[model samples]
Target chain A: MKKIASIIALAVVFGATSASAQTLKTVKDRGILNCGSNGSLAGFGLPDAQGKWAGLDVDFCRAMAAAVFGDDKKVKYVPLSAKDRFTALQSGEVDVLARNTTWTSSRDTQLGLNFAGVNYYDGQGFMVRTALKVKSALELGDASVCVQQGTTTELNLADYFRANKMKLKTVTFATSNEAIKAYDTGRCDAFTTDASGLYAERLRLANAADHIVLPEIISKEPLGPAVRHGDDQWFDVAKWTLNAMINAEELGITSANVAEMAKSDNPDIKRLLGSEGSYGEQLGLSKDWALNIIKLVGNYGESFERNVGAGSPLKIERGLNNLWTKGGLQYAPPVR
Target chain B: MSIDLRAGSPPARVPFYNYPKVRSIAYQVALCAVIAFLVWGAASNAIDNLQKANIASGFGFWDNTAGFDISQSLIPYTNQSTYGRAFWVGLLNTLLVAGIGIVFATIIGFVVGIARLSKNWLVNRAASGYVETIRNIPLLLQLLFWYNAVLKALPDLRDSVKIPGGAFLNNRGLFMPEPIAQTGFGFVLIAIAAGIVGSIGYYIWAKRRQDKTGQQAPVFLVSLGLIVGVPLAVFFAAGLPLTFSYPEAGRFNIRGGIEVVPEFAALLFGLSIYTAAFIAEVVRAGIRAVSHGQTEAAYSLGLRPQPTLRLIVVPQAMRVIIPPLTSQYLNLTKNSTLAVAIGYPDLVQIFTGTVLNQTGQAVEVVAITMAVYLTISLTTSLFMNIYNSRIALVER
Candidate 1:
């Protein structure tokens, strides 16, 4: 029994090593991009009843495909749960993982992966019903909080409570939907998760208006896509796709005006749209890669507002996700 | 197929080296070699993958701060505790649920199984119905029903049902008073220990004295006095060094009570009820295996019906019941992993679910979790095996 078990384990390890070494080439040969996603999350990667995928994460993968093949429609979204997301990306089962996964130091340094860039600057926050009249998280002494299990949200809950020396009782569930449902039905006094998730989950509540998100942001949760190491070409493509979107958003280049802006006289705009330099080719793509991405999926601001921001049902305010020019932390280096 | 074995024995005396026994030994050696080779190959492959992934492989992560909170634990645990300590908490919680489930499953199984053999129509039908209904449903679905349809269907915390002893009940769970062991509670522990020892000594003495003389002492009364009456007398002597910390009804929820969270309560109910159904069938089969002549003979020897069932039927039924009962205990313990589905922080949930996700040490986490469950099952089987052997039929 032991020998048979070990043989199977060995087969798995050997199997996991293949084809992943050349992620970009495999993706190109497959003629379709496979992107990992969180299909259950409302504003991030949920699929509609007709199986059409829509979310900020979905758009990010579409933008990658647009950059590579100049057609966002060629990408396929593979919905993944929290536990399967990282392993899926690591095993080369997906070309890119665009789930709303947090970019942590451990994930970046040790997971043989590279986080492209922060697409959402979310932080741990608490949500309570307005009827509770609770003003601050600190005032929530001995509060019963509902949280999703096996996520960083639970750890942050412990840290925030312990640092403030407040008593608390936590009710945990296997998924965000389950946890939010528990909180909605008065099983807990407060619901806690990322600020972005709090907004999305509040929209799921029976009385969305009754809940209020606490102002305190306890922990930094920089959620973004990640690519496996060794395939530097794929990593560069994933990283630059995000950078191009931010730069386009910063340069006032909307999807409708990107083609016109590519012809601008300004050197910065010209280089950003890949008109004056080999920046796109440096990442093994055409000089017009950024222009293709912008045309297909729009810039960062457009995607955010269209998916999770006020333009969507989630109505999540772009607090820290806004660009640096707007007093937010989102800053991308020059295309040059 | 390659062996030249048309004759039962070689026409001439075959060399001992080519003997079947020698060939069998060689085959066994070859099998061992193949197994060792496969294990080595797998180990090397695992090491290579870990290096390629840049994931350091070691047990070093056990000492790192867990930084995660489990809702229910039998041992002291906190976010600040080490991962090693969190593992212990997970282990203890798994044992706690499985241990409680085993005891309750046995009691319910015996009762229901015996009820099925009752002469009354209603009693027998009820037992069979319970066995059929509970055993047919999947354990996971039953857990969800217990958690959502039953426990969660209770009123909100503010509208908690006030039970006796100042306890509160709601969707949260049953909140009973916490017993605070005050000063001198150690004396109560000593008295209980003494009572157990005294009862055991008296029973042994009575058995030996009965063998020597035909006079049977009042062993039951004397042992009961030491075990029950002495403990009561010492409880007054110790000034009752135990107080109840009743949970106060608060605006949002109750406070300061020993709250049995809904997750744990639901899991315990599901595990015990589901396991009892299987155990009930096993018990019924064991009881039915005994010949009707055994009961008749006991009655013919002037033993009453109740005493006949208790002294003759039960002891023999136990001999048949114990072996399958052990596996049921093992099954119940293993099924407690279903606690993962309902948010119970069992060993698999806290360590494999949360810690493995946080650290991305799937191989290590899975190995440890597997080992823990194996140890628990093996220990339970070992204990049950001893009891089964002790009760096995002895014939000259």
Candidate 2:
């Protein structure tokens, strides 16, 4: 009888403990971070021919690995679709979600997730073929549009059309590739997605020069990384990793100059680089957590330039992602 | 005789455990208990896990505003409608596809099945070739072929090919004039319904007269006259209270008419063609299952080949066809869930995909989806079973 009671107790404990434990400890014990990522979207989280991932979101996961294990390569990228990303994070299938997911209020409160901070400030926009001769989105009245399903863009498109009092016909696909393909085939007058995605996907179109992204930024889409709720330590670590990147960029700490700057006498730089404070310790990480992130993944601006900015094929201008000191919104609180 | 039978029974009394009735009941009770325990455990475990994960549970999210647009909706729906309404729209779309797919498949299947047995070499080989080729390839690939290769290969919107009656065909879809019923249309609709009832009554009376007297009545012509001719006459007499709204080509789109989107058309065509191949095989086997003796018997009765096959062979073949035919119908309905692959916004795409994503209620959404498919399948089986029973052979 006692043995049976003990077995029942063990079962109860095992059942109660799943997905509610400290994520950092679990990740450390597992020796790698499982990062949910977008495997298709270029300049974000796509994998190349050699199976090596290189993008802004990919660098975010690398930064997390650097902060936790002092090695940026200790990450396994779990590619997820827009529909499955949050569930993957919530179910502990991925330790962190660095996909290009929007940080909406409902997602923050409703899903069991915490958006660390905005890494890319984007907005919904439309892409149309040049032959349409349509300059503004308002001219798309009574036109059919192709959009990706399970995305905030779908809702935004509907709302935008209804607000404009236009008759909208939408064709939503499961993936952005399908949506873009359908649009290219003249199945729709326009394809709507994030502005950044539009630029990246335009490169994949057959007649890349024929399509143009519309000038209307209809919805605020602050894309960022997220961690599961209930683990504040894990949340803080993810949040600070992004903040450190932004702060590094603000402090003029590029990856090439990060080692030189670590020896600087500036108070903020000293605290951030783990020379003057125990901030990393408080977040249950090594003293050189932020230092490793800077050394391995580079600062936020460097990552942006290499992945999606003028240095890359996407050639997206840093309009909203520029640093606060440069009159943009990519600001981080002082490390000290 | 009773004493001898009792003496032939076991010399010793059988134990309660050895009794067949007691053993069967005991085993059944144990199995039921085990099943109940497993179900309870799973349910509780799911509830506990959901609570631990901090994800809200239940069907409360069904009432929430969906805030999404469906490309095609049979009912009046907007983004402002609730998720429950979106679910109905998706279900209706699925039903529409399944219902049309079944009808087309049945017609094509019966024709092809009969043709496969034709004496003409080309027709038999062609029918066989269609069945073999279609049923072998995967359904998803067929759907993609239809959507991408066939339909998308049509002309662009600006270069739309014009069809008769103010219709246009483009890669986007087929655009046709929508019929708008004006004020006195109700009377015309009522007249048609009355005509249908009159035809059914006339068919029954004609069948009875043929049984009573040896003279056969022209039931087909009269029924057609009652159902179609009466409606047409009434429509003309009522001064044609229906007008068509023709589509106008605009700068960006062809606007102001009913449109059949290519995604829906492609899904319908793919499902019908693919399912028809299997249905044809089932039909062929069913017809072959009726022995040559039946055909010989019909031929010996002074009946012609067409009448023999239609009256004698088909009725018997139906008994064999129905059980498998029910399964095919169920398969077609369930396979319509693949609408998500091509973005047709069926129940799986709308409720399970979009709503589940928006609400982040995976457990609730998935459970509801499963329950819905279960109900649909069971309901289909129920109706098919009833029809089967009505036509089933009664034995002594």
Candidate 3:
């Protein structure tokens, strides 16, 4: 009799805790989209002095919000650290993780998450003081390097040194700010991270012009947004949102010109603007989903130039982030 | 028929609820059941949540390659080592810091504590000021201050401050020459071991002789000769088979020596200094808890100050000191987790921080870490309790 009573109690507790996975419905019911983002890295996902977030990753999250609610301001940004980002996504603390996280096999399968698509193509590189007069990473043998913990940068550093048959010493910190501080204070000979992160972090140094990023690119870092697994509907919503931005850019549709181009006669532009077909309806969204994304968040190129390109302080060249038609890796599938 | 009914009849009227034994047993059983239910509920809920999240749950990830390098590892480890090996490496590093920190804290604590009780006004004020200043501030802030303000403020790697005896200091770390023992070094090691054993045996024999006869032996002098003089004589007779491999400055860093990374140095100093302050208070309280009558009694018997403190007062005060001193030791060990903030790669930093992120096994990793700390704390308590019992006062 006691055993049956305890079993009934256990069942009640378990039933109350198990929630079904309907991210879109829950997010809509809440009337806001929760986006996990890097809040400190400038030109990627940092907030301004007024607490208004502006960056490429931040723009991606805004695009997701625009696609869902038709209003880009329906987002609440949750700043996350590198160590907590995946856990935050997995635990349903956020609807979509638009943080600058690299898409890797281990993360995709092991962490129970799915990568939507690569938004910023990056690679790891080294930055050193120019006064050292060292030009190449090979000259960094027996050098102490500072890197952030729980990132692919740490692993790539070790692999690079081992492959080149050079001794390496690492001093890892929990945050990029600390790593950069250590490097700036001369605790390390070099600071290593993604090339985009290097450019972004360089502006924080006391003497930004004294440091130079090396020419060597060690590993590929295809950073993108991620969503929880087992939600194909939510996955489609995120994947097509990125594809819409890329296609809009290829079709030469700017944020200012998106309304005028929506009335064009071309099949690709009409379909992308949700006028030629019921593609948005298939993903359980309104007919103007892609149109709202372009009008609100602009195309990928506009986001890039505004956040991290020639217009921003980072001044990073669009080496691999350009469109596939223009000799780059960003090739989004056709909406049709 | 003639028996008096009142003599035995009252014993038969007691109810079971009135029995102390039955009531106590029922209460204990109820408490155990409640505790068991709570634990089972929590475990099941965690498992259910993990399954719902589709996260892999088990200890199977321990065998996976870590692929991350640690700044300081006591054991031999590379990026290719398994997570299990990484766990051990991290555990050994944590133990190393705790062990060395405890010894230094105890020594500094005793000196400062005794100084606080001194008649000299300057020494007493200085000791009191140190204890007040260090203990009132948070340990985390002190650790950061030591790591950033002090150690990182040292000279750059290119302009290392060379210390005598083949050592160099820089912001990177302090590097010293490593000793290389050749084939004949084993004889010297064996001699040292033999000398230690001989000293112990001689001390026992001397104590027995002193107890049996009215004469005393020069036990200290003889033991010192056996322990120290024998090792020195053998080291010279064996033609000094030990050689030192000194560190040399490279283009980027000082290479080819045992480099004690600044992270370890900062954590060690921070833990030792911060913990010594509290330990000083504990020692002071313990010594004060011992009555002053014992010291005055020794002085009345013609014993001087040093002998009275050593032979009469300290022994009794130790009975009061052992328990709280154990607590300070445990606090220092647990506070070593602050190693994460400065990248020292202690157990929590490496296993729980890095490995948990890579494998995504939060439950297993966290459980193991908690168990490790529990075991360390319990073991420390167990040893201290045994020593406490030995020195406890005996009932007449």
Report clashes for each candidate as comma-separated counts.
0, 0, 0
Model 2 sits at a Cα RMSD from the real structure of 4.6
Report candidate 1's fraction of native contacts.
0.36
Q: Of models 1 and 2, which has the larger lDDT?
A: 2
lDDT of 2 by residue, B1-396 (tens): 335666565678777899999999999999999999987876787677666666777888889999989999999999999999999998899899999999999999989988998899999999999999999999989998899975568998888999999999998788999999998888889888998899899888988988999778888898889878988898888899999999999877888789898989999999999999988998999999999999999899899999998898998999999999999999999888888778888988887778878988776776677778889899999999999998889887
Clash pairs detected, candidate 3: none
What lDDT does model 2 reach? 0.88
Per-prediction CA RMSD (Å):
4.2, 4.6, 4.6
> For candidate 2 chain B, which ten residues in a row score worst on lDDT?
B1-10
TM-score of each: 0.92, 0.95, 0.94
- The Cα RMSD in angstroms, rounded to one decimal, for candidate 1 relative to the true structure is 4.2
Per-residue lDDT for B169-234 in model 1, tens only?
898888999998899888778878898898888889888988899668898788788878887788
Per-residue C-alpha lDDT of model 3 across residues A89-178, encoded as one tens digit per residue: 766667799888989998888777889999999999999999999999999998889998888888899899989999888988877888
DockQ each candidate and list the results: 0.42, 0.38, 0.36
lDDT of 3 by residue, B1-396 (tens): 598878875656678988999999999999999999988987788677666656778899999989988888888899989999999998999999999999999999999999999999999999999999999999989989999975657988888899999999999899999999987888889888998899899988988988899477887898888888998898999999999999999889887779899889889999999999999998899899989999889999999989898878888899889989999999999999888888898988888777877886766777788889999999999999999999887778
Best first by TM-score, ranked: 2, 3, 1
DockQ of 3: 0.36
Of the candidates numbered 1 and 3, which has the greater DockQ value?
A: 1
Badly placed stretches (over 4 Å) of model 3 are A1-20, B1-31
lDDT value for model 3: 0.88
Count backbone clashes in candidate 1.
0
